[model samples]
Target: MTRRWTHGRSMRHSGAACGATSAQARITDEAHLVTCPDCPDAAEAEAIPDDATTGDPHLIETLRDARDGHTRKIDGVVVDATTAHAILTVYDAATPKTKAKIAVLPLTVMTSLAWNILRADVKREGPR
Candidate 1:
């Protein structure tokens, strides 16, 4: 028996009930996923797991540490995958001209980090 159609549910749920995927379903508001039980579970089931961190304990540990409110670190230096990903996502979605402006961000970040480290070392050495 078909589940009776409801007003607030996503088209994805409606599609599922009717046994067809809808492109319209793909574009529906994300909030529906939160309020609609079946769609949320199906969406969770359909989500692709990040494979890079899946088997690597070190990467998993870093992500866990980040999620737990500690800044992520690799080789004892603070780094943030989340921020890096946000930057990359913007770059990827940018127009060509915008991409040109964004392309140097990683290098700029590295240069700033290096300069800060140098300044800290000079301060630690204390007038030598």
Candidate 2:
């Protein structure tokens, strides 16, 4: 029987869990992780660098949609908001050469969704 995700249920048993290494939930299936909206492994795979001066908190503040828990979808798949915000932080911090590499990723689809969020934030923040 193929299991479908129930909206109200937790994703802990959905074969989509991440960061927990017990053996069973380690999830080596790359394809499912790629497609699963709530997959934290996918978010971790994107891997944002921890640079002290990246100005991420400001950027995070600027992403009001992410703060509000709004959904950002990529190819009809809903992206976790914290993950999306983290991606935006990566984008904001990347160097020109590094950004070129990141811009072509499937995960970069979040950038499009983020554009609207950013514009709205800019409007609210008032006159950058």
Top candidate (lDDT): 2
Using TM-score as the measure, the top candidate is: 2
Task: Write down the lDDT of every candidate, Cα atoms only.
Answer: 0.44, 0.47
- The per-prediction CA RMSD against the true structure, in angstroms, equals 16.6, 13.2
Q: What TM-score fits each model?
A: 0.23, 0.32
lDDT tens digits, residue span 21-98, model 1: 555544344444344455554444334233223224344344445545665443323445654444444545668896
Flag clash pairs in model 2: none
Runs in model 1 deviating more than 4 A are: 1-77, 106-128
Score candidate 2 by TM-score against the native: 0.32
Candidate 2 global CA lDDT score: 0.47
Q: After superposition, how far is residue 119 of candidate 2 from its true place, in Å?
A: 29
